[model samples]
Each structure stands twice: as C-alpha cells, then as structure tokens.
Target: MNDSAAPVAGKTGLEFALLAEDGPARRGLITTAHGPVKTPAFMTVGTAGTVKGMTTEQVQASGAEIILGNTYHLMLRPGAERVARLGGLHRFMNWPGPILTDSGGYQVMSLQELRKITEEGVTFRSHLDGERHNLTPERAMEIQALLDSNITMVLDECTPFPATETEARESMERSMRWAARCRAAFTQRPGYGLFGIVQGGVYPALRRTSAEALIEIGFDGYAVGGLAVGEGQEAMFDVLDATIPHLPRAQPRYLMGIGKPADIVGAVQRGIDMFDCVLPTRSGRTGQAFTRRGSINLRNARHQEDQRPLDPDCPCPSCSDYSRAYLHHLFKAKEMLGPILLTRHNLHYYQELMAGLRQAIEDQRLDDFVAGFARQEAEGDIAAL
Candidate 1:
C-alpha cells in the first residue's frame, strides 16, 4: 500500500512504465540494463543456457524480449563462476536481451526427499551428480549476480498446495525473511533489478500479509509464486484477485510458472504484467501444438493426412512453411526436427497471444479480446481437415 517504496523509474537500470490500461489489464514496458521488455511479456525458458530445441536467435525471433535462466541448473553444471568468467550469461548463452534468474527456491522445494530446510537455507544433493550443496538467501543472490542477471528473483519457499494454514504461514514467513536477506545481499546497479516473490498458498489474508511484507522491503518488481501447482484455474484467479491489488501498481507484477494460454489471458485481465512457463516448449517436444483454436496432438492419427498448417494464421516457419500432415509424419518417425519446428510454432503462438493482449489493452477492448479468444479455443482446431 505504500507507493513511495516502489517507484516506476529510478536511478537503477530496471524501470517500468505503465503506458495504458483497460480496467484491470495493463500495457507497459520494462527497461532493464540488458534491454527493454514490452509488457505482458512471455519470457522463453532457457533452463541450461539454451532453450532446448531453439537457439538464442530463434527465441529472439519469436518476439521474446526476455528469457529466464535457472540458477539451480547453471550452478550445478557449467557453474555460475564459470559463466561470470566467460562474460556473464549473455555472452555465454549468446542472448543479448534481458535475462531473469530465479533464486532456485522452487526447485529446492521440489527436492523434498533430497533437501532439508532450516532457518538459514536449504541444503541438498545435486540431482545431476549427487553432489552436496548449500543454498542460502545470500548465496542465491551471489549466484545470480555471478550470472549477471538483469532481473533477479528473491529466494522464497514455494508453498505446496493443500498445505494447512499453519504450514503455509510458516513457509511464507520464512520466505519473507529470506527476501529481506536477498535485498541486503543484492548489489545495486543501473538496469539491474531484484524481485521479491509473494508466497502464502491459497489463503487471502496470508497473501495480503506476504505482499505487504515485500512492499515494505521494496523491490524492482513483485512476483506471485506458488500457484498453478494443482490449484484449479478458478481458485488461482481468486488468489490473484486477492493478491494483485496488494502489489504495487508502479512496479511490474509477474505470475511465476503459469500456465496455458487461457491462464495468461485471465491473469492479465486481473493485472499481472509478466509471466514465464515451460508448457509451450515442453508440450512442443511431445508433439502438442497450441493453435488459436486450442491445442492439438500431432501424434494422433487424425492429423496423419491433414495438409493444413498447424495454425493457418501463425506466421512462424512451422505454420507458414510446413503442413500439419508433415508435422505428424515427423513425429511419427521420431525425427528431431519435429520437436524443433513445433517448439518454434508454440513459442510464436504464445508471443502472438501476448501481443494480442497488449493491443487489446491499448484499444481498451480487452473484454472483447478475451471473449473472442475463448470462443476460438472452444470451437476447437478447424473441423479436422
């Protein structure tokens, strides 16, 4: 609730400007040390300094202004120290745009059987080599700094769904404490930003408390974490309705690790300004393509003879240059190109969705856009050739 703590622009290189809004929907731009990101942005996931099937250029070509890197993965493999010695992640990954590095809290939380959490930090064995490692809030900041991340997320516990109110509170409070430590440990630099994650499970009051706590500590941006993890869409929206209002309007609001096309649209409508997810790329590798008319599986025999593009309207190479039948054949044959081409198209579709949302907000027609998008998705992929 205190706007003074959160400024839209400051001496720091990371800045955000609210250009327009349609009701709760926002259209904005985030300026970082690396570059500028047009809001309602979808950051392609480059988990291990690579976007799986696509190169940095390919990711950039999909209209992505930013990409996310995983501290857990990078530190375990090539090592953050190595990345810094090689001129940071930008040069190492060949990506020159803005980069956001998560604090590894979520990944640590997922390693329930392998990790132990205490007041200081989490200690666990690396999944890659079974090597022991420690990750504290300060250490998390150190690793991201080593990677020279443009946007650094604070370390926070990703509270599991179905957690009791007491358990949620305990996890959220520890995350808040860790966030404060991250802020203290983070180095201030122009064009660089440190974001705090808001945790609290599905409880509204707890969410409010978490938001207020992060606002007090202050951050370049605020992210709502621990959703889309088995919580239904309606419940997720309800949590957003409860949390988004508490977040600073001047700074960007990111919904972490969220979700399908419909989820993004609904979150944007509720005032979320940024997002990242592995769904599009992961689904692509499995032969799933996201079209305007919902998702379709290429491995299904129904597409074996269809000559249409994945989505006739998509301008990506997979759609404009290749046919669904060919795509199907590639998947059937287990060709590597099938995943690459589909991943390209899927990323393009996600970016196009974001662009459409931004345009709708600018035109003050977000309501109409959302309705139409739902209609198209409901109609399903064009009556199967």
Candidate 2:
C-alpha cells in the first residue's frame, strides 16, 4: 500500500480498460497478475478456497474469469502463512485465473458478541476454537499479500444499518483512516492491486465523504461497501446514486456482497462494474435454481413429475442431461447429487447473465436487454406442470 503521495515509480498495478458503454452500463477488461477479467463480471463465490461442491475446472467451465476468496475463512482455517508456503491461493486452490480477497472486516463485524472493535483494529475469538486473533488494516494487507491475491480490499468497518448521521460519520471517518493505513501497508506489485472501500451506511452525505476520502488516498479500484446489509434495494441504489458520481470513472467499481440477478442489473445500470455474493450457490444447495424466468425451487411438488429441463435455455449438465422430475427426486430423496448438480447449474446461469449484460452494454442495447429480462421475470417460471 505505499502511503506516499504517488505510487512507487514504475510499479504499475492492475490495469482496466473500458471497451464500451451504454449509458451508465460499461463493458471493460481488468488485467490482473493471474489473467484478464471481463467486466461487468460476476465472480463466483469461492469462499474457503472452493466454490463449495464444484471443482476449479467446473467453476472455470461455468465461464467465470474471476473468483472471490474470503480472507476471514481462509485465515482461520488453512492459515494465510501456510497458504503462502504452499505457493499461494491460486496454486492451493488450483484456480489459475484472478482471485480477489476480502479484507475480513465484514466477517468480523458479523461476529457481534465475539468481537470488539477499537480504533487500532478488531479483536475476536475464532469461532473454530475460541482462540484470540487481531486484525488491523496493516495485518489485513499482509494476509492478502501472503495469499498472493490479485485484488486485495482495504479493511474497513462495515457500518451497520440504521445508524444515526453522527454514528455513520464516525464510522466512515474511522474507515477512511484505516483505508489510508491499508494503502500505506500494501505492497505494490505490477499486476496485483488494492481496492478502497466506501462505508457510510445509508446516509448520502457521509457516503460522499467516505468516497471523497478514499479517492484522495487513491486505490487500484473503488468498492461500495456496507450496502445490502438490511438496507432495502431502493435505499441501496439511492446510496449508489449518491456515491458513484464521485468515484474515478477510469478505474473499476465493485459492489460488495450484492445479490440477486435483478440486483446486479440494477447496480450495473447505476454504473457498478463488479459483484460477488453467496445467493446463487446457497440457493442451489437449498433446491433453488436461477432461470431467465426468475428462480424456481426444485423441491416443490410441481417439479416432481415435470420432465422438462430446469431451464431449457441453460446448457448446464443439470439441464442438458437431467429432467426437472429427476432433480426433484434427488432433493426429495436427500441425495448429495441434488445439491451438486444444482450448484453447477446456478453458477452457469449466473455466468450467462453476466455475459448477457456485457454483450448488451457492448451493443448499446442495455435498456432493451433489461426490458426483456424484466418481462421474463414478471412472467415467472414456466406454467406449472
């Protein structure tokens, strides 16, 4: 993180090039140390070094160019130092493409009763074995560096929702200070980079202030944090409306921990370029599948006798080789294969959605694409069996 006014001379970090734009929506490419990621990209959640049931090759086959790894989970289990010893996360996980690591702030925030936050950093007892650990902005940077992350996020307090203006401002300012420390502590690499996160809960003024402060410090990219944490969609978009204009347009903008398919579209419409979430995979494990006609539950009775593909449009093996009836049977029988198949299908569907959005942005038909998408969603899943 060079704390200096300018980046270390001759050390060019991550590179982003905007190839097309359709109003606020953008089509771009992010070249990282590992590889290139096409934007408006949807990074499959590979928390704990794996995307759950799917192999790295299966994840890659789902059309994902980038995947997200959680610092909190990895640090607690396999350990960051151990990961570094094993040739970093990419080699450890066998995922050759780019990997972005969260600084573990959000996970720490969620450990409400188990953690304490101070100006210096957060201290928490590990859920695994009740052992104590400290995570400061500098330590977060070091962990990500040890993991050899292509994109590392600055550690910022995840401002809780429903905070008063004063509370939000206090949290935002502290996060800004931590952002500066992270910037200074980060090790500059040619293709690896650090992203600064903007925190302010839902207060527009504080959001602007946080954004401005991070910009002053500078980063390889900007991320909108503290949204989707109980703030409804409209409020989240409102925050984006207030915050995005102040961000540097030439660099990538990421919306952290965001959401359903429609949520991604709406954020992209508001100019967000990257997203990661557990929804699709989590939903899949619970018998839900995403489709152009919205999401459907394979556990339902209607699917038990329906012989059609889960989504005829999807080329995933779950759809190409199995019928809705078979999928329903797997779930009903408590078979492990049920979740595995559905997870693959869900990731494939998400990748397809991102590809569609990218193509729409490139063709300057984003509005039209959105229109059709809304129409299909409104129509709902195919008529009951």
Candidate 3:
C-alpha cells in the first residue's frame, strides 16, 4: 500500500475483496494505499480537511478507518497546490487514514448564484471572496491529485430536484462525458483509485444509462450520486434498486452523502459498500446525539436533570465519562465542550453502527439485526440509564 508519489502497476491503487453477503448486504475489504477499510463502512466527513469540533486522534479513536476531503473547499481556501507543498491532505490535516475527496461538483452546483454550468465545465465565483474560478473535469482531477486523495470522485453535475426527464437525461449525459474526461485526466497510482458517480436524477432509465456508461469507462469503484440531494428515502431506495445491479459486483459500490441511519441500512440492504455524510458531526454541534436506540437532543429541558450517559450501551469516551446532565448544562451554557463531546459520541455511534452492520452481514443475520435495530429505534432514546 504505497499512497505516496511512486506508483505500482497492476495495482488498481485500491483493491476490494467481497468476503460475504447477507441478502443484498455485503461484508468486504477495501485495501487502499493507506490501509484496509471494511465494507458497509461509514467515512466521517472531514470536509475542509477536519471534522468539526474533534481532533484527528479523537476521530480515529471513535473507530473511523477513513475520512473524506472536499476538493472545492481546499482549492478555494488553502489552495490545492499549497496542500501538495505541505505533503498532501493527510499530512496537512494530520489524518493518517485513507481519505476520499469529492470531485467538487456538488459544491460548485450548490453555489447557484455564483456558478455557470456549461458542456465543458463550470465557471463560479468563490463565496470566500467572490473570486472567479473555472472548474472543468480536468481541473477537478488535478485538484484532487494535488490533494493526494486516496479515492478521487469524478466530477458530475448534481441534477436539480424535480427535473424533467429530458433535463435529467441531458444532465446525466453531460456528467458521463465529464466522468470520462476525469478518468483520462486522473493520474493513477498504486493505493489510489478514481470512482465514477452514477447520476440520473431519480430516473431509472437514466440511471441505467449512466451506470452502463460508467461501467464502459471503467472506474475503481462506482458511486451512486445525485439521489440523496432531496429525494425521500423511498425514492432514493428505488433508484438504488434500479442502479446497483448494473454496477460491477467485483468492485466496490459507494453511495455518496446518504443519509440518516435508516437510509444507510436500506442502502446497505441494496448492496452499497461504502458511505460518507456529515450528519452525525453536524448534528452534534446542534445538540443532537445519535444513540443505538434513537437520537437525543441535549438542548431539551427533559435532559437537564438526567444523570444517565447518552447511551448506556455505548462505550465512547463521551458516553463513558459524561452524564446527560453535564452535557445538557454545557449546551445550555453555550460551552465549547458541548459540541466536542457530542460530536465524539455521534461519530462513535456511527462507527459502532457500521461495525454492527458488517458483523450482521458476516454472520448472515443482517435481517435479524436490522429488525432489532428498527425496533430499538422505534423505542426511542431512553431518558434513564
């Protein structure tokens, strides 16, 4: 696993070995240049090179084997070239684990007021200082390469919600073309690989076309993108049902920016092997904590006098050392420790969830596990230890 500049041929830079399956759930191994990440793994998002409110060590201790980097944010703020000079994202951010960098498409597209889309690329103004910038597929590849991302996602225009079939088709076709360009532009190395995103804006036929197109282009992994943007979970699942079968069974399948716990379970049931999202960390700062039973809000008055840990079954530092009373007081006082502890707890919970999912798949008890999970969730977050 050499993630450094020197390349090794015949090594797709990433190797995936599917070891077991329970229904559509997969228990697999992903060998990256950095290290091995388990399938049905959840990548804690360090969007701007850091997960908010938590140190890298804390993040790792929470059981995250991999983290995600954002190309757009890095390019605009610290600049990708500067990161390269600083020895790439992992070194710059001081995160030693595998890092997956998005293609910068979603960020650019989200800048609706500042960006202009074209067949070739997108021209956008930086929200930081209103600086003009051009983001083509080639530039996207270069930026990610400079960041030294272990997994590079190809640039794809995130089709808007409620798009017409014709509109979605055009957007998907454009993304497919960009995916090809990104593939050509990306400099392959051992332990690093490019992933092509499947985009069809909730249209099954369009998804099929997009999936087939990416298959033809051939990527280290295939990612289902453009669905979790605004679609409800049911619609999202439908798209996955339509798309996953077309992707290569031998390779890894990534479902980008998805979702709540239920959404993840569903995607895993549909054969998604990898996932990344900011929900856990982001929700933490807002006083919400994810527990095996359900979610809890420290800001709620009911927690003010509670003496229990966030989750009795949890073994995270936050759950082990802190009480709901203390956490509630911290949030009420607007103390920094509030977000930090909650973020740590949330990340740990997410990792624990993934571990459970992997184990369930390996034991071929995924159905039982998922059923129990749903029941516990419906039982809601317990107020007492």
Full-model lDDT for every candidate:
0.91, 0.91, 0.90
Runs of candidate 2 with Cα error greater than 4 angstroms are 1-12, 382-385
Compute each candidate's TM-score over C-alphas: 0.97, 0.96, 0.96
lDDT of 2 by residue, 1-385 (tens): 1112222232239888778889988788888889888889999999999999999999999999999999999999899999999999999999999999999999999999999999999999999999999999999999999999999999999989889889889988999999999999998998999999999888888888899998889899999999888889899999999999999888899999996898899999989999999998999899998987778889999888888998888998889999999999999999999999999999999999999999998788999999999898788856842
Model 3 misses residue 222 by how many Å? 0.4
Alpha carbon deviation, residue 221, candidate 2 (Å): 0.2
lDDT string, candidate 1, 247-323, tens digits: 98888999999968999999999999999999999999999999888889999998888888888788998998998
Cα lDDT tens digits, model 3, 212-256, are 999998899999998777789899999999999999887899999
For candidate 1, the per-residue lDDT at 292 reads: 83
Span of ten consecutive residues with least summed lDDT in model 1: 1-10
Give candidate 3's root-mean-square deviation (CA, Å): 3.3
lDDT of 2: 0.91
The full ranking of all candidates by TM-score, starting with the best, is 1, 2, 3
In model 2, pairs of residues that clash are 1-183, 1-186, 1-187
TM-score of 2: 0.96
